[model samples]
Target chain A: MNTSKPAAGKAPAGGGRETARRARTRERLLDAAYRQFCEHGINGTSIEAITDDAGFTRGAFYSNFASKEELFLALTERENRARLETLRDRFDEVVAPLGRVAGKPDPELIEGAIADILAVQPDNRQWCLLNSEFKLLAMREPQVAPRFLESVRTFQQELAAMVDTALASVGLRFSVDSGHLTRLLLDHFESAMQEAILAGAEDAERAVRDNVMRTLPSLVHSLTEVRPPGS
Target chain B: MNTSKPAAGKAPAGGGRETARRARTRERLLDAAYRQFCEHGINGTSIEAITDDAGFTRGAFYSNFASKEELFLALTERENRARLETLRDRFDEVVAPLGRVAGKPDPELIEGAIADILAVQPDNRQWCLLNSEFKLLAMREPQVAPRFLESVRTFQQELAAMVDTALASVGLRFSVDSGHLTRLLLDHFESAMQEAILAGAEDAERAVRDNVMRTLPSLVHSLTEVRPPGS
Candidate 1:
């Protein structure tokens, strides 16, 4: 049950070793589940399939997670956390890059920050497919929807906060509300990425890169140039 | 096999009546299937369920379409046609409104045309859900994906043509390619509408109205104001 990492080399009795082993098993299961879910949809993928793919038995899956849904939710959380961490690290580096003046960030630099934050990878197509399946299922099942939506909202809020911090670091903010801008940008980005994947476009990552590089700088320019109404 | 509309009063003897009746049955089934698929996903709903909802027998469905996939593709074509017709009508109205003076269309009028074309409806949420499901399935199934992507590309090309006509009527064009603008605008609109539905936001139509009214005009302005490089 306790999956938290033990304090750096501070092994207490044999608990640390046991926790480490359990953590490895859980991570392995989650990784395999991600691939399987992407290949075969949620319903198409079974608990036994996930366990067998992970090289673990059904009992091992049950020991670490209650069910497929449980494992999927864990994957969702892990993916979101990993993405946020990547964005934050990239954002931090750009907003305070060496030789940068402490004023409103250059529109190009902000665009570069966004591009860095949103750079696509080979694995992202699978993630996008799996995410859409999860979203459709959540929409159909009312019982699970509230939790799924709550997670989405939480993730959006965290993303907006990071955007705000990144902007503030350069003494600038969106003329529109940062939260609204974040939602708009994220929506636009997700849809574009999804389309590129669905069309099986050659150089999908470059498609995203070329798109954001062209669009975001101009969008940020507009947001920065225009003042809020009555301001 | 012949789903085309019959010429007015130009029927081929007794064949015309049967053809008309068959067309009506097919249309009714497609409409019913749209509702059923929205409520219960593509996989979740059964053929029996669709037939029962349509007040037709399984024979009716089989005779009209080979399977659910066939029915769904037909629905997709129908939906695309309907939407394009609506946009064409509205675009015509704005592009050539009755007036004594004839010149470049006003920016505001073009904006109005765009807004009228994008007006949302109560049923759109359902359609979006069903469409997303279809898209995800198409992505997972290689056999279906090529056809689906081709359909998408055709629809997008048609939309781009409409956008081009609308802009030309106004003596304006996007600094970017019309096709790229069409894709960008569609992606933005669909995602915004999806978010509003997923969040169960009150006044979903109004939310779409407000968001598009605010964002699109500015986006179009940016695209129009700047000249394409070397243009």
Candidate 2:
């Protein structure tokens, strides 16, 4: 174990390495907390439980996160960032190739992009539970609401930007504001996952995929129009 | 207060009156529990807190509900029934007149019906929080899942039936399964409410009304078509 000195004075030689190690530690703690929070709710789980599950001490947890709520927020940010990155990568791989060869946007290509993006997350049930828990907490706790809203808006804006770029690549743009479009799509996707989980569908993930695929592609098509020729 | 005898050995003259009184007690308890749960979550609250809030003794609570979870489920049923009743009443007041008129479903009537239904709930933030909390609990607890699922399906089916009747009365019907269409509209409505609450909009209720109104009428029109002459 690399027991590096604290950065109280001049920068250490291995500062970059130390920062990477701290990030890994934080990630591990978050993973453990996520599992515990899903199994037993946020209020039911304790900091000690998370630290023990992560194989760390209380000191390590405090150094990383000030409180359980903060850890929850950090987890939210991490999960949202990870999802956005996955979407960006998937969109690039599946839809970017068609960008160069531009005519009217192919329905098949748009459908494929929607399917691929929806398919990126397979563990819909766990995610739905965690996300719902966080949302409820934010709603009830006024102090947490602003920060939670910020994180949500950040994710929405980033996703909206990606959607705009992908659409522009194919000579199309949303008839409504891209941000509004993003919110609508996300609302549908989240609702689909929750419904699938509640219904105890044989394959919750596939249920979400099928439900979304049935309506979202057509909705997207209707919401998009050919870009104007001139700016 | 009627300290009525138990309905054990023989039927009493006041049996019906006693049953009505018991139902009133249950409703009172549920109303109190809903407020407490909204204020300090399901898990954060205790049985004592609920009974105290309802001005009932522990015995009264136990007589009415077996456990907190059971009370929570009862609250869910009561709220769902209340909302359905309100929607039914609102639809009757606003759209039933048009039901007798025989022409293509007026866009204005459809919009008005949608608006009235959405406007029926003024406390979106509280409902969103409580609903999300219960959903998370249901997702985490397997025993609660089946009952919760039943309540959800019951609501969806009843709402679908209403939608079918209303649309048919206006010489139209859902192109898709009425249940599926109901789910889509509900998903959008719930999402819009959550978003408005999270954004801390000046009027979260109005925001939900506006957001749902903007898209749902168009979506509904697209989803419905003229009914077959005989069928």
Candidate 3:
């Protein structure tokens, strides 16, 4: 609850100092849980293991989060939020140079934007592993599936909005639904990254980057068209 | 061991009757493991659970496979081989009527072929879950990664060949690497299925079918071209 700003100086309600301290505790627990979940997986990891890794007591974990699943949901939200923020920043950076360009953006510009957005994820391998684990867990647990879908939809919408704004800045828009296009790009990027990691390639990062760079530009070129004037 | 032809009357190498019985046992164990792995997970399901589910002793399980990881590898091979066979049959069905087309096949023909190929898998949900679980396990386990990648590559190559043959039959070929194109199609198809399952949609199967139908044809169209006559 309200763990987004762990380092915030001021907090609302429930006593300022206590709330900030609690947020810090939750944040630390989430950090440790992310590492543990990525390394050992969700079901394979236990509450005690996460708490111990976080340097907290079981009581602390229970107080901060009711269950490992609850903690996982929180972590999912945090990671998605952070990723969206990075994408938003990267989108802005990619668009800031082109302020209302005439006609459609050049293929190079679109390709550069795609590359920048893709490169925003720093820990691709760990995130890919953790995301796949969470997905499988959600698929098995019916109770968690809807919540997982909600989080995914939220992230997709936010990223889609950023993509729309970025493309609109360059007088280009997707021929298909923006959300669908975003999902396709995200799926392909993750799949490529997963493949590279599974292959245990020495230059997995570069290989994924190159693969996406090679494949996605043409895809983007085909899926997008110039935004018609006078909507 | 040679578990592919479990029902084969004649066996190579060892005693025919004994080898046949062993292959049958291994096949049963794999079937049970597949169900168990999809229901629970690779890490969560014990070998005893698998053996018990197969109505066999733990000794039988060990005799057939060295470890759960080994069993998983074997299961992966079995599944991929089965899937490729299905795709091959489906491809042949889609192509047999054409009778060696002169120019590029029509868009509808291409789309129908894709739909048939995509529909070849009977249990999309189970395979999606099991495949994701295995991929995550491979990521965490170093020894299994290479073997996993090998299975994936073999599958990809075989599927690519089917794709190439199908396209060539219709006087069309991929502008991109056929293997990469096959990987992309498989990745998207699996991603769509996984999303539908995760969303708990009542018409999950239909939704995945429709999503791929809408998105992939254009992708395939853009990625393919008429095959050069002389080449």
What is candidate 2's CAPRI-style docking category based on DockQ?
acceptable
Q: What TM-score does the predicted chain A of each candidate obtain versus native chain A?
A: 0.84, 0.89, 0.89
Per residue, candidate 1 scores C-alpha lDDT tens digits across B17-37 of 887899999999999898888
Cα shift from native, residue A1, model 2 (Å)? 27
The reply for model 2, stretches above 4 Å from the true place, is: A1-14, A96-112, A174-177, A221-231, B1-14, B96-113, B173-178, B214-231
Residue-level lDDT of model 2, residues B100-213, one tens digit each, is 657556667678777777767757678778888888778767778789878988998998898788777766777666776687678778877787787778888898888888
* Poorest 10 consecutive residues by lDDT, candidate 2 chain B: B97-106
Candidate 3 positional error at B198, Å: 1.6
The reply for model 3, stretches above 4 Å from the true place, is A1-18, A52-60, A95-110, A202-204, B1-19, B55-59, B95-110, B228-231
Model 2, position B56: C-alpha lDDT score: 91
Candidate 3 collision pairs: none
Off by over 4 Å in 1: A1-22, A55-66, A94-122, A167-176, A210-231, B1-19, B48-63, B91-122, B160-178, B201-231
**How good is model 3 by TM-score?**
0.84
DockQ of each: 0.33, 0.38, 0.50
True contacts kept of 2: 0.46
For model 3 the local lDDT of residue A204 reads 76
Error of 3 at A71 (Å): 1.1
lDDT of model 3, residue A50: 91
Highest TM-score: which candidate?
3
